[model samples]
Target: MLFFSGKGGVGKSTVTAAMALLAAQQGKRVLVVDVDAKGNLTDLFEHEPVGFKPVEVHPGVHVMTMHTEESLQEYLRLNLRVPVLGRIGPLARALDFVATAAPGVKEILTVGKVCWEVRESIEGRADWDVVLVDAAATGHIVAQLGAPEAIRDLVSVGPVRAQTEWMSDLMHDPAVTALNVVTTPEEMPVNETIELVGRVRSELQVPLGAVIVNRVLPELFTHADEETFEAMRDPAAVNRLVDALGGGPDVARGTTAVLDAARMAVSLRRTRAGHLAELRRAVDLPTLFLPYLFVREHGLRVTRMVAEALGEELGL
Candidate 1:
């Protein structure tokens, strides 16, 4: 199982989609589990998520939302077969409160579902090469990853405690799982990634598979070329930079201005790359860098590109 997470809006879903697609294309039976309530992965696949059932999104790729409430209630009713009043009230009210009342209940259920998937496959009931979970952001991810331990400490015996211990063991097992931290080439996200890595290493002691730098701009110039780009700040030298960059005379004055904009874009791209290289130095894990999209929106095409990049990164 491969888990993908980081700060929100950092292209977590896109990365998840890409990896899932790549795995599927490689003929691996893949399940992309969406742990977020928003069902963004469902949206990416152009499906309206119904929250519980696993829906076939693409060939070899299945999607399911980690509806923790239902999972927990079912876990209680069927597994424990108990008659507890507080957690067994009317559906809506019980679910709402259970989701928000206890801190780790929701997180635990989410992890529990993923763990269940892994166990089912290992038991030979289900066959899958990979389960790619697009997990929640940092704080919640930490709690989710730590759920088994939390529950183990709270419950000493019986089925619930056994369940907790089993989940905890699965998470800590390096052979069955690995984590990928995704972030943009910005300061706060990078810092958060650093903190996240520290927490995972120090607390869980699980080795990260990789740190993915998304929306990266490829290195566009040498120091000398950068000096040339800086010289074009004069506007008078813009034409010369354009000539050196090698575009044709058919470029209208409007086109010249566009070329000037391209130079600025290239410079910014270089700046972002430098920041990414700094991040690569900051973390000890293997790094995968994805290029900035030239288009307006991300969809199947962009995701395919990302998957291609991932394949190259993994040497698959």
Candidate 2:
């Protein structure tokens, strides 16, 4: 099981979806649980939002959303044998209260559900080869993953305590679980990731996984390559190229536009390099960089592109 967390817009959902697809392509049954209320992880596979019930959107990938009510319902039905049977309606508003006052009580509902799926799968009661969680963002992830420890210390002699013991064992086991952070090579995102990494190592029991860097713009040229490209932009060389392609005002404008775009890309990559270096120095974990997609729309098409990139990165 892998929990993916990072800044809200750092493409965390996209990366998680891509990983699900990549795992499916590798013949693994992948279950992706969207832990955010407004999650669009299923949408990346061109499916509409789903409830706690998982929907198999791709060949070997299932997607589901995490709702506190649903998690509680499952907990009662399975753990306590309370037979809720659609009877949690009145307790819905109370969920918010528990979240505010009891803290880990609300978080355990989510994390426990995630850990349940993984344990069931391993024990042969479920069919997931891999469980990927689009977990809470940087601000909330540690608390979410740490719920088991909190509950174990506070509760005694009940299903909840038993749940915590098992979840903690599964979560803390380096072989079974990993928490991976997704971030972009930008100031705020990188800084937040660095801080989150520190917190995870110090405060959480989950083992760290690779830092997945998303939307990276690969440098388009070496210094020598840039010198050659610069020469191509020289007035004389530009004139010759324009004549070679049959010169016209429109052609000249297009040529200038392309050259300017390349120059801007080179500059932008150089600027992001500093942030990437900082992230590397601050976080000692395996890293994978996913190149930026030059697309206007996002859906399964873009998801597949990222999945293919993931396959390459994983040497699949």
Please, what is the whole-model Cα lDDT of each candidate in the order they appear?
0.79, 0.90
Please give the distance, in angstroms, between residue 270's alpha carbon in candidate 1 and its true position after superposition.
3.6
TM-scores, each model vs. reference: 0.87, 0.93
Best by TM-score: 2
Best by lDDT: 2
Per-residue lDDT value at 232 in model 2: 97
- Which portions of model 1 miss their true places by more than 4 Å? 81-92, 95-101, 227-256
**What is the per-residue lDDT of model 2 for residues 167-233, given as tens digits with 9 covering 90 to 100?**
9999999999999999999999999999999999899879999899999998899889989999998
C-alpha RMSD by candidate, in order: 3.6, 1.9
Off by over 4 Å in 2: 232-248
Candidate 2 minimal-lDDT segment of 10 residues: 83-92
Kindly report the root-mean-square deviation of model 1 from the true structure over all alpha carbons: 3.6
| lDDT tens per residue, model 1, 1-316 | 8899898888989999899999999999998888866666766666676467777888888888877666777677767786654745576466668657665667778888888889888889888779999998876677778777776776668786778877777777889889899999877788788889889887774447889988887666787987776665666675665566665765436556776686877868767766676777878888888877777775676778888988888898
